[model samples]
Target: MSTGPGADSAPAPTTHDSRSTPEKTPPPGTRAKSSMFSSLKVRNYRLFFAGQVVSNIGTWMQRIAQDWLVLSLTGSATAVGVTTALQFLPMLLFGLYGGVLVDRLPKRRTLLVTQTSMAVTGVALALLTLSGHVEVWHVYVAAFAVGLATVVDNPARQSFVSEMVGPDQLQNAVSLNSANFQSARLVGPAVAGLMITGVGTGWAFLFNGLSFVAPIAGLLLMRARELHVVQRAPRGKGQLREGLQYVAGRPDLIWPIVLVGFIGTFGFNFPVYLSAFADDVFHAGAGSYSLFNTLMAVGSLVGALLAARRGTARMRVLIAAAVAFGLVELVAAAAPSLWLFALLMAPIGMFGMTVNVTANTSIQMGTDPAMRGRVMALYMMVFLGGSPVGAPIAGWITDAYGVRAGLAVGGAVSAAAAVTIGLFLARVGGLRLSVGWRHGHPTVRFVPRERREELTAAA
Candidate 1:
């Protein structure tokens, strides 16, 4: 996912590193606990989680501020998209390499470097903008710089959770991570909006720059003794190729990445969508733009909490959530009034978060820990990396046709991709779709193809 400014694809084997997997058991004397907050019990994860909550709010704030600043300067939606694209372009070019880099280094140290670099980018922007010397090109350069840092930060962070919480808490921890981000989303945009309106965008950037301090402190504070470190991938010439080949062999892993490519490329360019709607369609200005994001965060927070309650991430959930996400966006695109559009943003946020959390948790829980950094890099590359391609296209469409056309195109592509991938996976896995009402509610089920045939014959 882009890690907003928002937001994985893949089914993967439920395995650990080449070394023996954690036994789905708790450490030492602690009993297995599966609460939504189970992962927080670990002192390391609690610290990490707390720091991330602070950092994520700052992230979202900067995202909103950055986009608004571009729009204010250029008054061009395409320019805004250009800024977003620049921010994610490096992830497309170097994200997999970053995974290789993470597999070779100490994750804690790697994160500190990436975090510090990003802070510098934020601070530089703050300095330029606050001094009243900032320009569109400066924002572009800083956005690209941040993207360069994220190439390492993203994969390192994804694979680090296991060390902090172990296999037993991996799924819950990932869900809570999404939840924590959404909670931050709820605050970040509203705060940024106010800061941009009442003060200026520079303050938001400055606060974001400072927020990096929290994660660095948390990393320093963690006890090395308690970490459940996974074996690092051995340094070798073929390591990157090896990781790619490993994923190619695993259907559970590769298909999800493919599906996400389509969705992320077309479906998830909300910075473009929301901004165009707020500025062009609604003519409501920064406050309206912020409100749209806040409403979506409200839905996203609800979705993340729901995801945290579930013990497992199923393929069924990913497909359903994605389908719902696309459909809701379609509905939202057609909303006639600003209030109705804002009202519809909630479900769009909910289903979008579900698609994100379900895919991320499923990928993390199902992959080999040794291969995780690489696999997650691919997952994120597909998710955030697509912004480079999609953001501009969305911007162009909005510029040429309208905001509604851009959104509808994205929604249609997303929904179509979900259906296509869902069926292809079923055929590959020897399952068939079974749709019927089990009680009062409509339901969709996947069963063995033979069983599906038998039931059809009996019917």
Candidate 2:
């Protein structure tokens, strides 16, 4: 679940060329160049990447600052949880309608308004903090306002990728987008910690507010005539229901959404987990907290780059990543020392990101363009909107049982969901998990049911 400080789980670079391209683009299943930065070759996408890099770093800074700010004011982990809940509560309530809005409106125009609103919210918070009038209520209202803006921004940005780079680089562009966020993840937290310690949280918020300028400028500078715009959904009745019905009829779309709901609700409550661990379990200050985030960012950056290099996202990859994410989190939870736990954050971040990039890319590739915004809204809603419900539970667990148990619960649920879905998909898809020796090496593979008889006869 990408949090407010940054749109952490937003789309990364991936390319899927639509048939409407001037040239005949390859089929949806065709592989792309494995270069991690391949999508940047397009001038429009390049501008978007550059602008987003700056904006995302600022976003991360705000996220780190926002969480710390709340913790400092209240001194209760539960209160911190409440702030996270407040930030995402609007997403739970209005995210679907935002999707409907995105589909009906021009994506670029919609993004412009949403980004500007978010910038205003950031500046308002900074002013409040700097003026010494910032209270718990101000923070709450700012969080909610940001959430409300995100309801539209999230889907608009996801569907906007196609317009920038077209379908050919869809997967690569999307993966790069994640890498961009992860890259920001590395820089933002370290800088935020220093700012928080050296100056105050106000400066970080101020920096984030101004950073929105880059994206606004970039959007204005784009050559509108060159954009590979998709067909917009017309004004019509039952649009929201139609979007839901479309997904409901497709197993490929619906299952991933369901899986993300469980994982997002339980596992992606990291801000709550990390903050509590820093403040309570480790007794480490903001600096130590920043270090943990930086290390995880390192892993996430690596994972996103690797995903970009792979050039394809499959259901199998998503399942494997989810399982690994859970196992790594569990291992991290059991680490006895702060340093060991910190080191484990790398793999945990890597696998967590793998699941993230995989699921997002798959959904986009499998979906219809006209319905893209609405479908992505549902995806974002499941992945992020659940934070309102999950954060409080995680906070309560962290406050009561200790950070370890809270983390373990998230890990267990994440792993269980991945395993359950994987096995069920295998059964329905007419595949069996086969274990055997290939030459001298033992191997496990998923074999099609029709191929089992031939393999048995040969053996």
Best candidate according to TM-score: 2
Question: Ten residues in a row with the worst lDDT in model 1?
Answer: 1-10
- Evaluate candidate 2 by giving its C-alpha RMSD to the native, one decimal: 6.3
The superposed Cα distance between candidate 2 and the true structure at residue 225, in angstroms, equals: 3.1
User: Model 1 — TM-score against the truth?
Assistant: 0.83
The residue-level lDDT of candidate 2 at 114 comes to 87
lDDT of 1 at 152: 93
TM-score of each: 0.83, 0.86
Clashes of each: 4, 28
lDDT of each: 0.83, 0.83
How displaced is residue 60 in candidate 2, in Å? Answer: 2.5
Clashing pairs in 1: 1-7, 3-6, 11-252, 13-366
The CA lDDT at 135 in model 2 is: 91
